[model samples]
Target: MLKWIAVAAGVLLLAAGMVPLAIIWIESRQARQAGGMEPHVASAQPARRGAVVVYFSRSGNTALAARHIANRLDADLHALEVPEYALGLRGLAHSALDADARRNDPARLRGIRPRTLDLRPFDTVWLGSPVWFYSPAPPIWAFVEHNRFDGQRVVLFNTYNSNIGDDQIAAFKARVMARGAASFEHRALLRGRMTRQIGPDEMLRRIDADWLAGDAVRAPLTARTPAPAAP
Candidate 1:
């Protein structure tokens, strides 16, 4: 009797593991059929005061947000393609493990398109990524770690199904600001539960100027002139 119970528990565990794999397979297949993850740039328009959108998307959720942002800002768009996070069980496992390990090493990001970008020309820059492990994905961290945004307004956006803690947000904001960004702001889209989540259209609708431009954190004033010896 004990042997039978043990066998049943083992079978149940195996089934549980397969369920997620199957779901990942179906979603990955659907995404591929729907024209795999691609960096989308809006119709060519004059960059809004020299703006650009750079983003890292794993399963296209963040890509959608990036596309809308580029359109809203009339800016050029670029996607960071982390080969290590390509669609598949292996890739999914890699992403989760890396994030779980909190590995923000820039070397983990490779083979991304437009290998080098000059951020100096852009007065405003938008960065987007999906929330992984309740934080911005490691590739986003890798990008920020490798680059600086001197004197430019930097905006960070995220698409998350679950909650993003304030601690993570604070840390990421501090890191971006450390890169010499003139200002920083963060925006997030919460899709809620899978059964009642907002669709892509609604998500896009929410990406307006008010949503993007709100809650800005400007760099602290430096070298404030002293009063004339208090008169």
Candidate 2:
């Protein structure tokens, strides 16, 4: 009777082990019967920069600054470019100079776009340009003029050969703000001569003081929340 009891105990242990195996097998079968599952694959869109680097680079200086700022901001970046076939660098120089001649001119680049840059999602718009004559490049001017800022923040990144200061920047700031941009900050980078040099860090340092450090402010067209209904 003792030996029979021992054998019964062994049978119970075997049954207990089998129960878990049975459960696993049953779950596998149920999963298969339901249907084989496939993993989801996501489609990609164009890279969106939290800070859109909108720039007009005639000699690549402004574009370079735009890239530097994008890197410093730890932001994604994009460049809207003109075809080299349409205008070589030399041609671009002449056009930029002529554009300076028409300083007051506000013509958009003919057929130049992703028509409207979708700056709506981004709170910060990093506006970059090579200062042409006494103001920002014409394309840069046109870009600021055409876009409706509504409630967005604007930061100006400007590069020049030599001889520019608050007069130019203040005017540029006024022009952009007039377009309804909520606010702006100015950064200057010197190009073309070794007489003055502003490395990327210095440009970014100034930009941070003016915009990103969060001092300058603008009034919102609408309150952050709708004002309580006036009785």
Candidate 3:
């Protein structure tokens, strides 16, 4: 069941089959949230065999959170890189188009494809990406398409500037659930145009399982951020 769901999640992200961005943009978010475990430091010991972090960051916010999580958990990390686009809005735009195109033509997707990430080797995969148009970034969609996640714990981390990330997280949950992951959880780190507060540990602690059940992460923390439009 999980094998099929994991493959489907990645495949769906990889293919649109003539679907447009609006529709894809509209029906966003998936994957249920995992609850119950306290955000304790991953003891100096290694996690289950396949403990790792695979992420895509356009604005660096997601990257920051990914690295922090990796450090706290002492997990292997893999960053999704696209050679052409550097980062920021331009990268976000490119990612948006890339996902749209892939939705239409799965084969059109390109760029470094790893022989394998070996999910079989890890017990959990902390997947990260920046939210775009209320959905996930293209490279992550591509990552999902390329890798196989069987019986592994699949957790999602996202960074967003536009909206608070409710829709985006929801969509991610749906996608992962379809993949039949061993378990899944989604958390959005507030950054970029969004006012970021709370330490990594606190953020992890705040990510209670109940919040995963619904879009109730936190109320807006309106701190004066650097130059940028509202999200």
Candidate 4:
């Protein structure tokens, strides 16, 4: 009886370990199929002549999306670095705690100083961040808080593991607009366990079709009204 119980326990543990591996394999195969089936197209013209993509990516997933956006828009790319919080397991734990704090008390959140990049020449800025705890990563908030976007177009992008609720989007947008962004747009990619989430090709399509096409931009510029003729 003792032997049977030990065997059962071992089998259960092995199966548990194999579950994640199997899921990964299946997702990888699906990703390959999606990649093969998707066709590439020329990137659309930028909304403005000068543009830049600034992003913070810990797992490289957000970086991939930022690269695609920058390439499609023919813009410069910049990565935000947080060396102290990007090292290993301890770093990851620190990041999670920071994210939680930011979510709860955004005004009090600090640290994560992004490298300074000149934004004066750029009229359009693409900001990207990985979703942490249903909020934009703390590094992203730090970068945005330190920058000025007055009279500039700001487009936001977020990559998530599974879910990205509307409330998170609203919160992020409100924060950016408060910084004096003239216009705002956003796109999100779902990177869940199943592999059909927006890959490179899909991301390009979304950028061209939804973002570059101006569908995502909120509050279009209103034309100046002609003054009534003096009577």
Best by lDDT: 1
Candidate-wise lDDT, in order: 0.72, 0.57, 0.57, 0.69
Model 1 lDDT-worst window of ten: 215-224
lDDT for 34 (candidate 4): 43
Candidate No. with top TM-score: 1
Reference-based lDDT, residue 21, model 1:
87
Rank all candidate structures by their lDDT, best first, as comma-separated numbers: 1, 4, 2, 3
Question: Per-residue CA lDDT of candidate 1, range 56-152, in tens?
Answer: 8776667877776775555778889878788888788888888877745534543445456788878888889888778888878778877889999
Off by over 4 Å in 3: 1-50, 88-93, 99-115, 164-171, 178-180, 192-231
Q: In terms of TM-score, how similar is model 2 to the real structure?
A: 0.56
User: Which residue ranges in model 2 land beyond 4 Å of their true spot?
Assistant: 1-50, 83-93, 104-111, 165-167, 192-231
> For model 3, how does the per-residue alpha-carbon lDDT over 1-231 read when each residue is reduced to its tens digit?
999999998889767643444332322210111121222233245544446878865444456556556654556777777864453345435667876675565456557434247667777788888766566666676676667677777887775555644654665566666665777876665533433334434544443332233431222223224357778
lDDT of 2 by residue, 1-231 (tens): 999999999999999877645534543443343222211111122354345567766444455456545644544455555453123434545565555565555453433354457778777888777665656666666676667776778877777766565666776788778878888877665643423445444554555455355532222212235558989
TM-score of each: 0.78, 0.56, 0.56, 0.66
User: Deviation in angstroms for 231 in model 2?
Assistant: 64
